[model samples]
Target: MASHPNSSTVQIVCHVPDTLLDGLQVDMVLHSHAFVIRKTGSFRNHTVRRVMTRAPIIITTIRGGLANQMFQYAVARRLAYLSGGHVVLRLADDFEAQHERVFGLRHFNITGHVMYESKLAVTLQQLFPAHPQPIPEKIIVEREYQEFVPYSGKPALAGLKTLLFVPELLAWRDSIQLAGYWQTERYFADVPNLIRHDFTLKDPLDARNQAMLARIRSRPSAFIHVRRGDYTSPYFARMFGSFPPAYYHHAAQILRTRFGADLPFYVFSDDPAWVKQNQIGGPDAVFIDWNDDAPQCDLTLMAACRYAVMSNSSFSWWGAWLGERPGGMVIAPRIWFKSIPEFQDVVPDRWLKI
Candidate 1:
């Protein structure tokens, strides 16, 4: 019932140092960093203009929904912090055109410079003149290296992580762009408070949510998240399947056994009607359907809980993670994706995989 460091572990084959242990508390080679970060400050130039920084800026793009955007920002943010670099984001104009998503990073207290796409190329060339092929060598996708062939090559599933905390990345001196999901906690494990604070909502919760927050804090509470909507599409359905009713039944029982039998469960889902019909969170589960259009509010409510029954969705994963307490329990599905059997890096080592 208690969360401890991970015992059994896997390695990131691409120059990921041996001491960088994921779940174990041994000689941690994974704790490697190689950068001389200059302190950032503003100075006045001879032109009477403000010079923000001389430090290299790691420019990454944000082009996904709320949870996805968070991951993109987090990895880049951690890189900047470790290397004494700054983050410059290129918000894609086509995300809204392709998917029903707007630039979602503004909702949190994220620190970064947003560059217009029109000006990005000129700035990149000015910043790093040594790089060739425009930015090809600088662009880091999750599978840019040869080690990813086992999982990404598609001949047969040899099972590799969706992404890895490549130790080589820490030694980079020039600016780079991250184009992968980078959905692993190892990126920011040592800076929990900093990451949690950055994810805090910029705006206050609404009246309805405020009352709900009070209720959640008043007693022993747990949250349940069900991912539907876009997840029902064939692409998403094939990548990550939904959890069955039995999984929830057993997860809820696990919480009840640990925290009291009548532990009140607050449910957050894309489909509240389906949840109510199936009683996924149990009959007395409080369905939070009001914040569908407002993810920040919904996540606030989810994180307010002391425990969580996580859906195999990044949205739910963050909710459980953000609100985690000392002895809190988070129950996640054993399988994250149907195709990527080796990509289990997304789940935290402390969480229970049932």
Candidate 2:
């Protein structure tokens, strides 16, 4: 089976002799089929059977840090699963050089594959030469040739041919190219087990993180994630501001009262100094200063904890979601974004929001 250069559908090419051509029958497998037959010679007949074995291709542009990438991947995975399509993760290269945002999905045990923008552009050029506008050099930039599906908190139509998810819509089409940080649990709630399996870590924790993981599992630990850095910047603060100090304090108090005052807090943060200065965890907490180079390690440690006090960041959100315990508590800020009004879907219904 070979994948189409322009579409996500895989072509199942089959060759049949001229003698058997009349009697040959192809069964409808997963979804649909596009059959092509050609005569190679006077006595020989070549039958090329192209079956849409996989769902329509959902090529989504993945950006930001690990958690954000996971969000994009999960949405695409669910969409593909529902529509019987394949997913091609288009990693945004512009952020790689500027923000050091590497395509970190490989670090997880995800089933989907990824393609570089340059390779996708070359494939498009070879496939669609008659197209007027060139594919944008940056995947984030809008182009007329691409079909972008806008999200407005509604389920997408069933019969869409080629849908592109830019932000708002939840659509199911034969083929779609999605681009959004779909932070809602509702998108993948039906396939929770599949997502949990896919999001598992590809590699085991290293010695340093493993030791920390042991400590996290040893007690009634509460994982507290403090996200600063980018959120504190003047421009980003307006849109994605840091959770106020009071939020953390309230979350800690709730966790302590629910669990126990002696419950040890495992603190994870991009800015360890800021966590130290703020004294977010207090005397009973352990500050995990290591694993700056390995962010997934931090996530693993966070999940290992029995309870969680998450930040507004998606990074911490995944930590809490993955590490969720049956009886344990997860406290999050009611407000996810400072500017956005419709982030109610970001947090799960079960998780408490202070």
Candidate 3:
């Protein structure tokens, strides 16, 4: 079972990179008493009323893509809940110590602290601190280029997290390589965060989600994810792939025949345009537009759905895993992305492979 912080006094440090701190600011503030500090001295004289040493506090960081950032957030949230201290993203000069060594870049003061996790409460309990030991530098900084992907917006995801444990990360890396295909390592190098905890997708549009759930609760509903991309850059273009339009169409057909047209299908995807061009003509299908506002929340909300139809992307993997409901059905491509098992593990055992 998960736990939560029970402290009142808190000290949060924004330790996000120079680039990603801004995007996640709102997410951090919502969870705890969070603040951005440029140096260690920033917290010099702050008064902490609570002092519970048994509770754990989190100072987390990571370097990976957006999917990786989501993983990091998931891990940090679980760690904080399990340990009792709120999660804090340290955003000070000293906080930049490890990042500068790993990335070999000198930029500091990244983006947002709220998006990934909340800062732990500032209390005397933290003075003794109870958290996982730090992962070594070798594991954290080895083979930097092996993890790069071609997505232009990768920095958005990479910048969204901080490094906490390096050994666990190295183990995850070694496992992916052992699975075969060196290229697979890059894509999955940062996936440990997903395994840390199960995410529960919430409704994106607060009012609409409440309204939709209220109505859908009275009847049957299905969530569909129509994926249409195999991200293969020029270097790895040989792996270029796209799912057959028939894949989604066939799944939709199965659901319609079994569940009836009266069931509502909430279509969640990264690309709405592609879905429109290829979606099965079903009156029950309702395409949910993310509106490009909160990408992280939109994805999480989709994952919250009990029923899902996933594509072959880590983005969808996290969502499907989180959204899985008891006795729910998840339909995914049997042969996903160049016939690679590395990319296919996103399909959990609960999902039906087509």
lDDT of 1 by residue, 109-225 (tens): 887665445556664544333334223235565652334221234443222232555655546665566666777787778777888999997768889999999999998799999
The lDDT-based order of candidates, best leading, equals 1, 2, 3
Stretches of candidate 3 exceeding 4 Å from the true structure: 1-66, 75-204, 208-210, 213-218, 229-240, 281-284, 337-344
Which candidate model has the greater lDDT, 1 or 3? 1
Report lDDT (Cα) of residue 203, candidate 2.
Answer: 73
Error of 3 at 100 (Å): 20
* lDDT, candidate 3, at 171: 27
Question: Which parts of model 1 have CA positions greater than 4 angstroms off?
Answer: 1-52, 122-137, 144-165, 170-174
Best by lDDT: 1
**lDDT tens readout by residue for model 2, 1-354:** 776453454556666565765433222122233333332212122444333443355677777788888888898788777766556677544547754766677667775444555556553333233333223212322232234323212343222222222443345544555565667777677788888888878779888788878877877788899999988999889877887667887889888887788888888988888888888888667899888778888888888888899898888898998888688888888888777656477888799988
List the RMSD of every prediction in angstroms: 13.5, 11.6, 10.9
Candidate 3 yields a Cα-based lDDT of 0.43
Model 2 residue 64 CA deviation in Å: 1.0
